[model samples]
Target chain A: ADTGAMAAARTRQAQLTKPLGALGDLEDISVRLAGVFGSDRPHPHGVAVLVAAGDHGVAAGPHPVSAYPPEVTPAMVANFLADTPAGLGGAAVNAIARSVGARVYVMDAGVNADLPPHPALVRAADLGAGGRRGTSDLRTGAAMSRDEAEALILAGAALARQAVQDGTDLIVPGEMGIGNTTPAAALTARLLGQDAAAVTGRGTGVDDATLERKVAAVRAALARGGSDPADPLGVLADLGGFEIAAMLGMMLQAAALGRAVILDGFVEGSAALLGVALAPALADFLFAAGECAEVGHAAQLAHLNLKPMFRLGLRLGEGTGGVLAAPMLLAAAATLREMQTFAEAGVPGGGA
Target chain B: ADTGAMAAARTRQAQLTKPLGALGDLEDISVRLAGVFGSDRPHPHGVAVLVAAGDHGVAAGPHPVSAYPPEVTPAMVANFLADTPAGLGGAAVNAIARSVGARVYVMDAGVNADLPPHPALVRAADLGAGGRRGTSDLRTGAAMSRDEAEALILAGAALARQAVQDGTDLIVPGEMGIGNTTPAAALTARLLGQDAAAVTGRGTGVDDATLERKVAAVRAALARGGSDPADPLGVLADLGGFEIAAMLGMMLQAAALGRAVILDGFVEGSAALLGVALAPALADFLFAAGECAEVGHAAQLAHLNLKPMFRLGLRLGEGTGGVLAAPMLLAAAATLREMQTFAEAGVPGGGA
Candidate 1:
């Protein structure tokens, strides 16, 4: 982030036509945008919602961790890419992204099935050598090799870099992995040094029995995975899903490139935890979209110290929450760049 | 509210691609919107933000209740109508409204000075016979006569009815009265039977000394005003500002016309309290935009049982908070009306 640009933005905010600090978070957001864009006037030409899709190996056992079948992952991936009558894609994220004028990009991190080629789907080949056909069961061993994890992260970073080069200024990192929250809980618990039972939540509206199973899965994954908090990549390879690793990469790269990234729900926040672990400064580039209904999301946000933009109890995680918050960033940037100062408007009593 | 339509909306929400209740407040918003529009699919054609501006005589004394001078009221009224280079108006509300595709209508319910006419300005004559040039000191006497109070509400209702007739499906009631919070706190304290100090806040960032004075002003106003909660009109006439009365009318008429109304900040919520006092059913049509910085807003919302859409700490009360929330209503309606259902998308396992 450009400290000079941020300072300039803060100065400009005081001169805007509202009482000092009256705009609150809106003022903070615009200043952050200025830092990210390194310009006094930050205007995003393109907004992109990246829905990373993969399968969770822990969800495949007889006693599954998720309420929905693992098959739903690939099915939802197809749903996300499918065009609807509204001209938006077939999913909730697509509708919201369309409403906010954001384009949705479906990333095939490592889904189990071979999805037919689609224009919107970014396949493993595009993600580079780290991408593979999902992962082995995390309950037994590491989810992926360290090399593969590194490659996946690199692939995700490359995607974000390309999007920025293509004029996309804001990136919303979302995930679509059935039973992914099991890994997210495990990751957060391990990173924050908290109990798995405390971090675990019922994903996709699981019953009490299923929730217990999910909690056990998170505990098992943590026990088997590397425990070193410093080795984020090693920990990620052990317990993280392909999409989670990819999202971590996307956050890191987006921040390095001076672009904005909005994180959706628990799965995305887990990815952000790893991103922040790898590069503490990555936290500066990230925005928590909302306080989702997921139990661990609040804990994760508290750990990151990132105040969510809204709290609509959203638990759906295909960039829906992130896309919904994208407009706020737009409103912030517009207000900062366009609103007249008290002197310019010939109004007495300046905001300062 | 159309109960059948609300039920249909609830049912349809379960069928959407996400899990049951995963959308949280968004689902509730869509259902309520269906109830208000009397359709399972409620698409709004126009979103109008009514910013009612008035002066407060209580701000004219030696120890003013507000940080800004009372003259700032009419100046802001002009500011709200001034054109900016971005094609939006000159104020915070205008920038936010323009970003969300909502039209801003400045209502001069009572300005202390003579104002030139503009296309966006709704003059006093248009507000009916109850409209006057500001309000007297509530600490000394009644803010307006009971007749004026009733007439102002009727005029506000007429404007709301006309807007609905002109294809507006959403209405946002905002206010711009310097020292307005003083009157608002007094009215709330009287209606809710609470201490004046408990409800009074630092309006527009008052200093410690000014805050003391403001609280004292509220206490004096309430002591002189009517205390009966049953006679809402009398209470309003005794302590409410012109903008607050007009906003109360807007809420009543908007609800009656089946158009959704978003409440801005503390001043707007105070008006909403009066509206709900008059017609308890009006609660169904109102949405609290955000948790404003005012100390009394939460108390007002708690009384109304309305959950704010967001909490960006906004206190600039020219419909800015309300305008920012209009987009969420749009997104909610679009998701309900456009997203493909689980069954329609050929995905397995129903939400039930």
Candidate 2:
């Protein structure tokens, strides 16, 4: 963030039509964009939604919290790619993306099932195959070796770099992984050093009995794979899924390229927390889309010192929240770029 | 509201790709739109922002709480009409309206000074002038006589009806009344039976001394103009501005026409509260755009059993919040209209 640009944006906001600071978070949003873009005025363009899809290893277990079977992951990815009649996630992402002229790309980081090729689809293993058949069972062992984790992270970084180089100014990081929140809860609990019951939530509308199972699964995963706060990659390899690791990689790489990343709900928040642990500066480049329906979302947001733009309690994470937020963010940037100052408008009150 | 359509929409929501209720308010928003449109799928179109602009006579009083002179109201109205250079409010409203294919219309319902005519400009005085110089001081006497109030309200209703007849599918109600929160706070306190200190907030970023003065203004207004919960029209004549009264009329008439109304922050919330007092069913047709920075907004929303869409702490009242929210609402509606169901998409195991 450029201090000169930020100061200029703030002074400009004070002189806008409304009273100083009357626009509240909307003003903050525009100023932040100006600082990031290093300009007195900034414009939003070349937006992209990156739906990082994968399947959680824990879903293979008989006692799963997910209402839908893990096979739904690959199917949804295919659904997003075809976008023919679109699914709920695809419908939302596509509609908002079209409204803001953003292109949608569905990335298969590590889904367990076979997926057909499509123009808007990319394989995460193009970075390197983190694993061929999803990840290892976190309840018993490491989800992936450190090398696999590194490869996945590097692949995500490479993808982020490619997008920025291709003229993508903003990245909305989203995910689709059945039973993924189980690992997410595990990762969150480990990184924050808390108990599983405190962070576990109803993933995919699970019953109370299933929620308890999820809590226990998270505890078992952490207990089996000891985590260290100093090593984010080690923790990710222990309790994280490919999609989560990939999202973290994207944030870090996007931040490095000075491209904004809108973090979706809880699933993406977990990846961001992990990314922050790896590189705290990544927070400067990230925007929280909304308060998610997941129970642990509040804790994660508070820990990250993030004020979410909206609070819709959205938990369906195909980057839907991020996509929904993109237009408003664009409006903020547009306000900075297009709104004439009182002086420029030659209105009687040239605000001091 | 269409009960059958709402019920059908809820049932269909469970069949979407994500878990039940994962979409939260977005789901509720779309369902309500479905009910209003009498369809399982609702689409937003021909959306226009009705900025109810007015001036408060109390602003001409000594020790007024308004930061800027009352003349800023008419100037801002003119700014909204000429969007080339764009004021802050104009820039935000226009950019967002354009993003979602909505048109911007500025209404000089009762600005104190003269405003120029434009293609998208309309004055309620075309219904018949309510007063020569905006509204009278509510702290001294009734803001307008029964006849003036009736004419203003009727004009609002007429405008709303004309828009619906002219193919408008949605109305975003906003306000631009300098020192108007004084009356809004008074109306809110009266309707909710609260005290001035409780409901009065810093309208447009007033300082501590000004906020205290605003509280006193509300107290004085309520004292001078006795209010009756049953007599909503009389209350408006006593304590509401022509703009606020007009907004209430627009909502009631638009609700009757089965058009969706997106209520902006506190000022619009106050008008909607008065509308609900007049007709409880009006609550069924309204959607809250965001949580306001004003102190009484939560109380106002609570009394109406309304859940706002976002919590951005926005206080700017130019239909800015509604225009910002329009994209998300469209995405929600498009979700219902375009998304394929779990069964329709086929590769799924729908949970029981």
- DockQ (C-alpha based) per candidate is 0.71, 0.51
What is the docking quality class of candidate 1?
A: medium
> Candidate 1: what lDDT?
0.85
Q: Which ranges in model 1 have alpha carbons more than 4 Å from their true place?
A: A225-227, B225-227
Top candidate, metric TM-score: 1
Per-residue alpha-carbon lDDT of candidate 2 for residues B1-352, written as tens digits (9 for 90 to 100): 9999999998888787667787888899889999999999786677877777888888886787877778778878777766574332354566566655676766778888867767777789887756446788888888877787778778788888778877787888878888888888888898999999999998877779988888877888888756686798888888888888888878999999999888888889889988898888999888888888889999998988888888887887888888777777777887777766778666486555
Candidate 2 structure quality by residue, lDDT tens digits, A186-232? 88898888789988888677888888888888888877756687898
lDDT of 1 at B13: 90
User: Candidate 1 on A1-352: residue-level lDDT in tens?
Assistant: 8889899999988988778999999999999889888987788667898888888788886888887888888889988888788884778888888777888878899998889998778875575745577777788888888988887788788778878887888999888988899888888888888899998998788999999988887788888755578888888888888889888888888898888999889999999999889899888788878999898899899988888989999998998998899889888888888888888887778943
Q: Judge candidate 2 at residue A40 and give its lDDT.
A: 76
Provide the lDDT at A146 for model 2: 83
